[model samples]
Target: MLGLRFIGQGFAGLFGLIGLFPVMAQAADSRLQRMETSDAGRGWEAVGRLDVDGEGFCTGALIAPDLVLTAAHCLYDARSGVRIQPKTIEFLAGWRNGRASAYRTVTRAVVHPDYIFDGEVSTDRVRRDIALLQLQRPIRNTTVIPFQTDNRPRKGADVGVVSYAHDRSEAPSIQELCSVMARQEGVLIMSCDVDFGSSGAPVFSFSGGKPRIVSVVSAKAEVDGKRVSLGADLAKELQILRAQLTSTRIGSRMPEGVGRVQVGGARSSGGAKFVRPGG
Candidate 1:
């Protein structure tokens, strides 16, 4: 979700922070019914909510049974500005309202090496702003959303975004059905408005019979007149994610835990790492 507010031509809001998009509760036009049974082949049972400490949280979709995809910037240690230790995090599946249907522990995190949190127009951070979390066990939810892998919608295609943004927000709600503006660099920019808690929510275009995720919410674009947004390509990132997810051991489930460690800044900085993209 991108905002229309102007911080600066170079200021692209938070690299992984929630993009400020206007939130709206539109009618559910989706023809895709919530599946009562899990589709194992499509990796549908992996979507979950990521919670850290108590305040910092974000939405995550499952790309595999044991792997969850989200914005790399989401794992930052805002206080220390460094990467949070994966062992301290937890993944809750089918998270809605205030409760998660199923939960698991995150053993490790694999973020895009090219992910640069600095806010700059020229930097490729916005396009590759993705991260993968390996869950300790496979979540057994039956109502998993399938990833869109075929017939990707073109620019201006009607699409919807869903997320449980804010504590009050419910299941990934549909904001606005805007069209795909353009693929700036490699990022797919949309016209839909979003907010902070909606980070990592899936952007889907209704095609065939189900809503396929064309892109996952990365960062929202700002505008002076035109409203545009950008999303990391799930197709490309999933390639790297598949290799990592398979190599890692699914092993035993991790016990529930909630604590915070430093992330994203210099190891000794002891605060959120602020890296400005060089113009």
Candidate 2:
């Protein structure tokens, strides 16, 4: 997170550490439904609470039997920019009312190489705010199926999200109909309801009657007086992160891609977009 407040120029709220921002452009009928029981959490078993060092937490989703996807900042010390040890992190899959469908320890982790923990809150920062965690052991539970992902949808496309928040830490919740307000520089700004601990939650698109992740919640910010969640393009960014992790295992340099610099794209002057210094 850039900080706990928006500052009218840069986004500052990172979920699980900052106060919830005022509801700005949330879908009127999309109420959070807590999955406190097995039945309620049936299809969402892969959405888990990421317990970081057992002190703080964030939301993560299993993209593979042994691979978890989440926000890069969640693995870094917000104050020191030091990366947190992978051993201390735990994935409580489908945690609800003190139980989890499966529990696993993180053995290795990888963040987008361009992700700067101490960077200012800008499009560049949010565009690369993604990470991948390899579990010590693969979770083969049938019920805890890893989610499938799709490309970023066009603006105004309907989306969904599942997450654990500071208030609803015991059980995950789902908001089924948030709207993507805009897309720019590989970032998607949504009118979804996200808060502290909601970082790294998966944004789902149910276009073909199947829930496919289209974005990963990076941070929540207010845009044009309306609260919106920020995330990178899932399909593209995930590939970059996967390549980074592959290089890590082989002790080789990462391949060049969109994770680094941004090509020319449209910039918005409205408060709804990511603003640079005095932008």
Candidate 3:
């Protein structure tokens, strides 16, 4: 798999995690509000961390189960700065070190052959920012967001992008939101603030009375600004992902370490980890 490095260096300050808040606490348009807050309006659960080598490592929702989508750029050779084969790495869902009940290793990755990271096509950055991972087994406990496969949102639609960015701050909690500014040249550009840790966040739309994922956060505008964009119209890539997910058999339960465990919350079945609002 090949792709661009999302946001590159210096993205930390620019993205600020504060930018992750939705433009409006709630959309004013009754129709849009209803769609965005509906049951179907959930976003993807993406886990990304800065690895020991200082590169972004990520894995996230590709479908209901059996697949984890991410940036292929994360799988490069630490020494040579070259693309690494998809087989050399692993994907852990609900990942937490030392927690046996919070992780799962991946079995395969499908990378787009045309992915490039040299910044040559800065104008059209959406082409290769996506990839898919097939888990060795299926995950069944987490909620999965539905994707919109056909038409994307028109320019200026109020959209939301969510990820477990850097560490949680006072802003952008579990389901942070943002608004879409434009969908140009294959990318869905938005003003939702995202930072280094949010590389693979899902970009979603409130359409036809329901929320649906239309794109995945790929990278940001030149770090000179706070907003970012996602790769939309990867229906071909999504088709590949959906096929893998549907073919795999659903497992009886979430593998140990393969689902979210709220960080500061009581260890109940599947509660969220709470962080003091100002902590």
Candidate numbers, best lDDT first, in rank order: 2, 1, 3
Report RMSD for candidate 1: 8.5
Using lDDT, give the best candidate's number. 2
TM-score of 2: 0.81
- Which lDDT tens digits does candidate 1 get at residues 1-69? 443332222344433333334333233434222323333213333455577654445677766667777
Q: TM-score for each prediction?
A: 0.69, 0.81, 0.59
Q: Residue 17: error of model 3 in Å?
A: 26
Where is model 3 more than 4 Å wrong at Cα? Answer: 1-56, 77-79, 85-102, 142-150, 169-176, 208-210, 222-226, 240-279
User: Mind sharing the TM-score for model 3?
Assistant: 0.59
Local distance difference test values of all predictions, in order: 0.56, 0.74, 0.44
For residues 1-279, write the lDDT of model 2, one tens digit per residue. 212234322334532232223323444639788888899889999999888655567889999999999888777655444567777789999999888999999878888878887766667788788889999999999999999989999877889899987668889999988888767678887888887678789999999999988888887766545567788988888898888777676313322221211111222211112212111
**Superposed Cα deviation of residue 172, candidate 3 (Å):** 8.3
Local accuracy of candidate 3 as per-residue lDDT tens digits, 1-279: 112123543222221222322332234322212112223323333332212121234325545456666654444432234444433344443334322122445555555555554434443435456667665666564543224444566666776654544443112223335656544566665666555445555565666665566666666553233434555455665676556545655442112222121133332322222111111
